[model samples]
Target: MNTLRIQTRDGRRTDISADTLATLTATLRGRLLTEDAPGYDAARRIWNGMIDRKPALIARCLGASDVVAAVNFAREHELLFSIRGAGHNIAGTAVADGGLMIDLIEMQGIRVDPEARRVWVQPGTTWADVDRETQLHGLVVPGGIVSTTGVSGFTLGGGFGWLTRKWGYTVDLLRSVELVTPDGQFLNVTAESHPDLFWALCGGGGNFGVVTGYEFDAKPLGPTVMAGIVFYSFERAVDLLRHFREITGNAPNELACLFAVRTAPAAPFIPEEQHGKLIVGIAMNYAGPLDDAMRYVDQIRNFDAEPIVDLIRPQQFMEHQKFLDAGQPYGRNYYWKSDFFDRIDDELIDVAVDHWAQITSPLSSSLIMHLGGAGQARPLDSTAVGFRNTEFVFNMQSAWDGDAGSEEHIGWARAMFDAVHPYSGGSSYINFQTEDEGDERVRQSYPAEIYERLVEVKDRYDPTNMFCFNKNIQPSAAVLRRQRADTSPVSD
Candidate 1:
């Protein structure tokens, strides 16, 4: 490794030249901390507790130039490199062991253009920041359900939230992205120019490159919207869930809802007795006129079952994002498995009910999001986001105690996913994918033609397979042959 001629933020490597260190320092307006630095340990922390990788250098990138410099430095030495946008990925690819991490946490700039109904954002900024800024102009970007999720990663991996059923995924609204390629070049990619790269980044995860900033088309939204949770007993969960699915599919675009089976928490709204009980709750976000939203949701609210709690009402969209935020805290280990369903059938409902009975941790919850309407209208070729044909996204999460209970929770999730997979559209949301699995799984996530196009784009940008950490698609010569054959058919 001594002959590697590596670059270091500090004096860890004796082979690094003084000139290279000086150039690196000039690139970062902020501090570049090495492994031996005072805050090195704290800076490397990520959302998932299971990931404990330690990077050699944590460059707190001040601007795009810093990112470019970091990429080159890592490439020059052949050292492993990783990009940290929001570091909220459950897969924990943001931080790699003994590699370089280009931390973008300092780049939290957001500018809203109300007249144009668009917003420019830095990768470091979160959904909460976007909402807070855009709400000043009565606008919003369709983002992740959690406000704290980073725009860079969330948008890259296909963001779906309260506004998803209404406005489609976040990538649908992206107008442009400013990114630094793995080869140390800065480019502005969009529909008109470098369209392939732009398409790959949409749902390509972080495989293509590090996106420094994004320009998004914002939509008119609410500072206050009708949203909250409506709880039902476990015994009636199947009936309630079936009805919930139907209502959500037929409901107005403004009305977005997710059904969850979780251990009831000791919140003030729930009765003291119901605390710790297995319960099914329909969480909702209605983005249109409150009266109309209420009218649309009345069918579910008016159900005959005596409800334990009805906390649904008009509140700030920001508040709605924060409602479940407290429940999902940092440090508890998380393992997730997801299935995309074309329709919610009775067989699937039975599987859900069977698993709902065995949920051991209060943090463990299963989520079923309604997908369709505006979701399916987006052209398959518009972005690399997969599972466009599916109408529902289901996640089986198991957040348990220590390593001892790992097998139990994981088994349950796998079993539940397997049982209902027959109804799945042979695809899943890439963001929620835990195991890298294989190329076939990734291919299944997207339509066949779109997957091949993405492979071509990946070959163009990352030919050497440097950014193969995420759901990777290595472009083979065979793929090129087919592409050429398709384009070069008989011209007589």
Candidate 2:
């Protein structure tokens, strides 16, 4: 493979020798793919259609040592590097342009300790893998709504999911992480060890290091849960959405709901006439008893008309998790923006409905997730996750078939965000960010003090910023000055 020699984006020729490539390949038990490999195209593909970058090489890491060797090789050769977990990042940062990619897809290992109620999962594993493993003991950890999302990116960005209200963000359950630093030193990060790194990983995204695995605190949950959708037409959206806001505000922690506005899919439960019509749908998942949970949700039936579908009933956790899977598949052009709101007022509802009526694609949709109970109760500084106390967090997304319709869908998403920006909390969720947003939005994702701390940590761990593909935190000059002034030494 001639060490995958290539020209950089700035037109500089860089080279790695054939012997170095052989040494790198032998470091891992898995395969190292180059341009000549048959799986190169499949390995480079990500979840979004908008991302099209071809890496010089893709190293499928089998274990921790493989990750360390890859990092060291990239640093030594001055090659740009990227890390791939489940390859589901909407921003498409998982793959780089003409760089070396360390693909963790071969490291799908999960160990569940039922007595301790904890689970250790490797980066390549998906949420569906974790849910299935933990459910055997009637236990589960909080994860994203989409089962395909990677645990590494999801938890790093303070994961919010179907059980957020009851269990808190996915970062809240994170007990420890195994990471390889930019300098290729491996460290186990947790509250008791490398506490600063632990804080930075919670919501800082994958800016600091390549996390190989995560140890999470799992909770005792159900083999069965009460969940399903309650669909309503767009005509009653304003009233029904406002009513939903009021109810979730006072609802118990075990109850969680999401308000989605999209064209109704052709499901057996929905009438065929409404297949392409815009509708306001409530996706509910309650972890408590079925009869009591239904009591609080029965008020939804009192709307002006009968719902197009009411599938709320007792079902297994896996069944409810799989319900939303069919709508979201791989290789679609996706654009998403997220923010938090203190309330869903009539003004905000009006803005949402207007955008809903003009939706340009079937896959386009918006989500308003309630943030109360367990989610709101966390201390602001308990972890690096910012905007924890907001009343609700909402995400706006636009998905379409191909590039022909991209501009129209992207324009609508931006307009919808602008209309509701005034009502939104200043910060945004890190996982939903787009590449065009630049550095400012990344800074806002964390609190000011926490962001400063993250920069200091960046100076200590990744001083050269080898992992600059993510939402970066550049070390400040002041931090360097403080480090010089203080003669205290720390160990890795």
Candidate 3:
């Protein structure tokens, strides 16, 4: 009489027999855990604290085969399911209420081929794991700044990081990805093989299937590079912002900088008195010659506006990758509203600082990131990550603790985005958006033609749209037509 209560995507309830569950668990090389099992609560948790969902069961996948088995089991049961890679997605997509969850945390394995400048990465691995291994050969795979973010989601969602100016988004370097589609079939997709699916995976999030591994065309980089931070008083916020623009405007491809208006945290480098004070500064990393890297930030380094503290210097590649980790601790409620920018003019600066002035939570901050260089050189058709022409990106990143004050924090982020919406180019980064933004924003972020193409690919691989989560892309018109044709009354 050991039955599991489960909910389907259509909001129907069903019970799974203990015998059926045992059979599925036996098929997997991995173990299956029920809600009452040890570690089930922890396994169901994700990065964003606001997401507190409990799946009825967790299938902790050990390898690609385990993923395939889990997918088939869930599909057979018609159980609502979610795929958890690193469990770092801000949308809390890793788990759904009373559903089945395929957890990939146990599958972190990385193989680096330095000579070929390629790396084979399993989905559960993080950027930190890749950097630790890739840096051993003086090679780098362009990844997100937060080292904890999983490789699969970030790369598939168009990853951009400190090295983007010098190299490109992580997807640009992708050679192939191994995925288990909604049909429970494992297919290795690349630009040459299954080009359409490959295109969709470049930035389409998790609509088509569950990705198991990725093969990347990694680039040679540094074990040590010139990278660091500088903090300035908010009194000179405008001047500091102006300097930031000038520095990144015509900057060399080897330099990538991030400017922000944040309340100074109590770090050793920041003065005790300045802690909690509104401030502005730029965090920079140089992927070029060490000497040139030194000369790169010299202007701002010696500016008359004066930096309250400057820590820019040559450091290990690893240090800069996780530079912002402190501010983005796990279990904190997080919300981010983002936009694309053609330039950072005076008006935009004023708008950003105004929002910064009204920030209710000390953890909330505004980020202006420089875009372009080698990444811009790539053709628009090279991948699905459109809007490569933009010169900048705006992010109003908000983080607040506990539920009591969540509204106040999210309100600040939304208001800030609205104030600067007119300045935006009518597009945004999909990965930075919250789940509430929904399908419309997902469709609007890409060109109409590009989005339609994504739908077509979704139609081809997952006609029923089983993977309908995480900034989902619905199946195209053709898929609906075929489904109707198959189900319609037929004459003899």
Candidate 4:
């Protein structure tokens, strides 16, 4: 029966009586965690090892009703709160210091409609979870490359993966979402039902509300497909990169490839001497029929020079989705800088190669993900997703074992990002942004019209700016002024 001191939306601290706290806890079917609670520390630990935050209260939500309770409590108290799904975001915005943390990790639910080729997924469900059920009927939802990524954050922030070239970004597959607004109203939002809200959520990054469930249009792809990676010597990085760009430029919708420059891992497929040495790799997924996929695979296999390791072959689609999982294990310190590219010119390629040679950590890498195909075919105004006409995405990902050498690793990523930014399309992916990138970086993530439109949506649904943690989009000043005026006392 201890009284609690929680942070308010305006950054002031306020005390809540034990009775009040107990009332909220009692209404929840899930548990409410205080600082001294048994699982508080474990619940706060997220995928990134660098973030160490402590929320005043953690509401472990078990279902939509639990989410409703938490949202209502926070709104009534005017408490600052953050939402956590799988806690996999690199920015670590899920847990707010001294504020309420709506932990949705326990709400893992997935219902698939085989006949409709659709899925209704709970916020806590990960790409791996969704894939498991969808693949039961040989259907799939386009999701993030990392299997551990949460469906909620990934979908809200414009998700893409191996199937992106064929199916489009994850948001494109979204049919509807079940949301709990800042004011505690539950809404099942769809394009036809709530056009503005739906557009804002497509790539808006959790700025509007807490989404409990996502309904996605799933497409049939694979029980098995031709996919894997090919490793080459770093000495031929320029030529290999050019080859990768050339082939990908002419690639069909079913073929997607990512070019990476990093040190090789000590896997059995690679030569012992080549392990831990710098190398360039082309990881590919060809989702069409096996017969047609082999033709594209053969072209890479027969490139001018022999590959150091060739692991490309037919594999289960789920296995292909998890190809990068080992490299992105949870609790590892990670820093990322990303942007979209209109084209991979020689200058950008050289800059990336130069930065690759100066890599501070063995776990760090520079990635060039080929874009276009189905994604580009969609109009720029079709959804809130930014930079549709771009040809590729470049990400400078820095991963290290611990907190040691953090400066060196981060500095390297920033330096690389700066060198290659001039070649960028001037917009970046919201999902890849880091915590320190600031509000301007967020504004740059969308087009001028799209950013302004997102703000209008925010003004309408979240005028108080209750959810300001993720790449925040603030409510308009006019709306705020009107709200203040309406709440002011009447004259005598």
| TM-score versus the correct structure, for each prediction | 0.91, 0.95, 0.97, 0.98
Task: Write down the lDDT that model 3 would get.
Answer: 0.86
Better of 2 and 3 by TM-score: 3
What is the Cα-based lDDT of residue 91 in candidate 2?
A: 85
Give the top-scoring candidate (lDDT).
Answer: 4
The window of 10 residues in a row where model 2 has the poorest summed lDDT is 2-11
| TM-score of structure candidate 1 | 0.91
Q: What does candidate 4's lDDT look like per residue over 103-200, in tens digits?
A: 99998999999999989999998999999999999999998778999998999988888998998888899999999988888999999999999999
- In model 4, which range of ten residues has the least summed lDDT? 297-306
Per-model lDDT: 0.80, 0.83, 0.86, 0.90
Question: Clashing pairs in model 1?
Answer: none
Model 1 agreement with the true structure over 1-492: per-residue lDDT tens digits: 112233332324435555666667777787777666789888899777767888767889878988888888776766666788877777777887766788998899999999999899998888889999998988989887878778888888778888888888888999999988989899999988987888888887787877889999999988889899889888899889888877876777677888978888898989999998988888888889887887866876877788889888899888898887665666667788888888888888887788778776677888898877677788877788877656788988878656777777777887777777887777766677675456677777787787888778877887666676566677667755676687685978
RMSD of each: 5.5, 4.0, 1.7, 1.4
Q: In order, how many clashes per candidate?
A: 0, 0, 0, 0
Which model scores highest in TM-score?
4
Residue-wise C-alpha lDDT for candidate 3, range 1-492, written one tens digit per residue: 289999886679789999998888889898899988888888888889888998988999999899999989878887888888898877777788889988998899999988898999998899999999999999999998788888877887888988888888888889999999888899999888898999999988888888999999888787889988898999888888888888987689999998977889898878899999988888898998898887787965856766888889888989888888888888899988899988887898898787788888898877888879888888876778866767788888889887778888899999999998888877666777786898888887788877888988887888877887577888977787788799789989
Local distance difference test, candidate 4: 0.90
- TM-score comparison, 1 vs 2, better candidate: 2
Residue 25, candidate 1: how far off, in angstroms?
A: 3.5
Q: In candidate 4, which residue ranges exceed 4 Å CA deviation?
A: 484-492
